[model samples]
Target: MWDRLATDGLAILVIMCLIELIVPSRAKGPVMWGFNLVFSLMLFASTLYYAHFGSVPTYTALRELHQVPQIKGSVESLIEPEYFLFFIDLLVLAILWGVTLSKPKSMRLGRRPVWKIGVAAAGVVSLILSGWYIHNGGKIENEIVQAENLGFLDYQVAAVLKENRQNDEITDGNLGKTKSEVKKLQATFAYKDASSGKGNLQYFGAAKGKNLIIIQMEAFQNFPLHLSLNGQELTPVLNKLAAEGLYFPNFYQQIGQGNTSDAEFMSNTSIYPTGTIAMSTGYGDRELPSLPRLLEKYNYESSTFHVNDVSFWDRSKMYPALNFTHYYDKPSYTNDHFNAFGASDEELYRVGVEKLSELHKQNKPFYAQFVTASSHAPFNVPKDRQRITLPDSLQGTELGDYLTAINYTDYAIGTLVERLKQNGMWDDTALVAYGDHFGILPKLASEEFISSELGIKYNDQVSRYNIPLLIHIPGQSSGKVVERVGGQLDILPTVANIMGVSLAKEGFTAFGHDLLNVDHNIFGMRYYLPTGSFFNDDVLFVPGKGFDDGTAISLKTYEPVTDITKYRADYDYILKLMKLSDAYVKQLPKRGP
Candidate 1:
């Protein structure tokens, strides 16, 4: 409890000291007290945020404060009476300041170097102790545990130090060396061969001359694909598409701090997000090896469409780094006041089809990506757009709101498909659709609530991160449900294979494998889960200080496995793989401003 208190107070002290440095000598006492009050309130807000998200907020999280207007309702629900205790000191100080102001004379410590020195020494001692605490934590992969062990202020410092160390280690490294290492590591594992005893590269280039369209659905989960509520299908459009395409029900989301944008980065580049920062904000300056850069060689024009401003997550820089031929952002679409994004998914698709149709008229094959925003957070859908009616019990609940939004999003996709078909591009295009990340927060939508209402067993970690991945090949009449588990990292390799782009032949390095061909798969997740947590064929393994103390849950049963000894190899392999991914990304050439 004392450690926790110290951890919480550290931010207040730093803020107070910074305020003291700028204030005039005569006003230092009251001004310092006022700033302390303000800083305390910030601490209270952080506490509430932590309670809801189950993760400590870093300084970088402040960049997302502008998103509060869109999620105000959800944010309000997270606040509690206990969080206000952080402001108790502020309250006491405020009352004391009022009393002092009311008096004719004020108490003043005039030029007391001894007292100032003592305060400075105290701050120095606190810093030393915090550093010592972090050192004692001993390299835990779990961010939550690391924060708890080192406290919040120290955790931020440690995160920076760790990132710097990673950058240093890969400073002189080359992608060729990393590619060789990855090949050697993969050769150690026994992936399933094709039926002909040849490699599973048979499907490569099956759609070489086809146009490509990828839809990155917002906050959509796998459970809604065929599920019905009140005899009404939740996602009828996606259901039909899944029936006619290759659907991977076992696919999971692997986004980090950037969330949707990170999903975009992974799907396009096949590299892992560092989990310490938003990939778009941090590595957007790197000359990223992506689908756009590869397809450019085939005379294909690459473009991406989104309803939000390109500056929202720094996509302006990211697009150029990925070498996209063109992009359609907010100005390119009609604003329909769709949440904070300013335009509905329908408007986005309308604009997208118009632009792609122009390219099609010129007989140009193109790569077009649509980033949906209608089903974003706080999940409120306009009444006119609502397609599914909720049960009386869930009418005003978060789950109901989510379903309503998802249904609207699905309906909007139908419009895009219709446009494609009308333009005569459907038969010649290989369309891929996937969800960027999970929607419901575990605090609001508990396991019991989901199982009871949705009739689906929802494990917090495993099921919450599960998203749908569907790929529709032109003229393909039946769907195939691939059981292999995959993540956002696998999207690029899988799509490239379908497009007949050979990463190996082109000397491109991919941290992920082609999900359609790989018999066994393992993917790492670090944002919502711990850094070392990984999902394999049968289980989700989460590390606890180290492997021996770690835990495993059966993916099939969502129940804890008694013995996790057999999964040790997966833990080691994933840890090494993620480390290599981090190193490889750091070593990439940075694009100039």
Candidate 2:
């Protein structure tokens, strides 16, 4: 904390000196007090944000602040008693303020010409020191490390400067040229098998001409798939689905600031979230090349269902951007007393089945997406609504509540499956259900705490980011536990492969590869992890300022890898790939208003 003092301290000093030089002597106290309060509040928010998201809060984060009221339960859950210590200094300040108010007159620190000159010089000196601190840390692609090195206030400023620099790069990139460069670089990675000299024809046409149904489960994790709480299976329905489908146990979420919405964006578009902002909020105006758009050529009518308002997370714009033929939101579903755009996952699927069954009767193939919210943060489900019985250890605990919500979510999907079968749409449809992101935040349930409770070796980041990806193609009898390391970005290409849709033939530019065909794969992640952090077939590698001080842990074994020099090339490749992805998405043509 002391080492970080240079950045924040210098910044505060500059501000204090500036106020002294500019403000009236009588009003100085109130102004400084207000500044202090704002500073403290920002620090407090940053702390809680780090606790919840495991990333430093930047100015970009403020754009999502408007979303806080909608997720008030989640925000409240993130707060702790100890976090109020950030405002302890304010207690004394407030008391002093009251005493000063009660007094007959206020004392003034007389400011002469020499004193003003000294204050100005001090401000200039402190400003330079703050800039120096920012300069030292700004080059770091790792946000967490940069926050530690530059302190919180300076880090925000550094982020803006870095963002501008990256913007310049984005502005300079050409769409056609970038698409070519992406393909050229991707060929070097060789996603398809060299031995077969073909695309993943194994799964090609596997579910061709079938309707598509994708369930974007909320805050669900991979660990609960085959696990039991006491004697009860936590997610029996999902376990059954995993048994019947191809499940990617090594899959991780690639969501950014938009979280669930970002998962949808990546799954549909095969584009990076840019990590700095929510893709839906930022690029909802662009005409995205998506699964819905791709399937349209094959005569598949696309629709999406969410229990929340379409305006939430700007999904109203994103659905159009993705070129969905239809969408169902709040008014389309029955409200079950879920407030502030929250809904039971069961109701969400119930409506999805009802609407899609109509399309089934019409004999039209369709692509339908359902984004669930029942298991969102601070997972709450009435006891009557819960599916699995919890043990004494988990009962009433956040972990317990989370498990119950996940179980209910899985059960809801089971209803969707049964309804599809009853509606005669099951055998002709490709069913896919995957978690949008991990449910359990570390602050509520620490790795050690969860490991002890569940009797499993739970890694904080590795297991936390590990979301389940299951694809159930019609007529496939048994399940295959795919061992390939994949992210949410891989969903589109993988689904396309199963449905026999060739993105290359359509001239579509995709940053992600077909997980089924990739013998070797590497993908970058940011917003949650540091910018240059990537997961390869072997390990999850995270860089320090650059690749030299980076660390690696085996993806399979969850053990640290000491010698990471060999993985440096993979790190470099992923960095370039993500940058190109960011550039490509920015270059996309805007939709006609």
Best TM-score among the predictions, by candidate number: 2
lDDT of 1: 0.84
Q: What is the C-alpha lDDT profile of model 2 across 206-276, one tens digit per residue?
A: 99999999999989899988998778888888888789989899999888889889999999999999888
lDDT of each: 0.84, 0.87
Q: Which ten residues in a row have the lowest lDDT in candidate 1?
A: 103-112
Backbone collisions counted per model: 1, 0
**How do all models score by TM-score?**
0.92, 0.96
Clashing pairs in 1: 205-500
Q: Measured by TM-score, how close is model 1 to the native structure?
A: 0.92
- Residues 1-593, candidate 1: write the lDDT tens digits: 46576764664465555455446676876777766776676678778767655566777777767656645666787777778787788778878767756755434332466656766666676666666766776488787777777776677777777777777778767877987887788777666644537655746776888999999999988888899998999889989998988899999998887888999999999999988778888889999999999999999999999988888788988999899989888899778887867899989988999999999999999999999999987887888888888999888988899999999999999999999999899899999999999888877778789889988888888888899999998878788888899899999999999999989888888888898788788889987777889988999888877788888998889999989998888888888888888888877899986
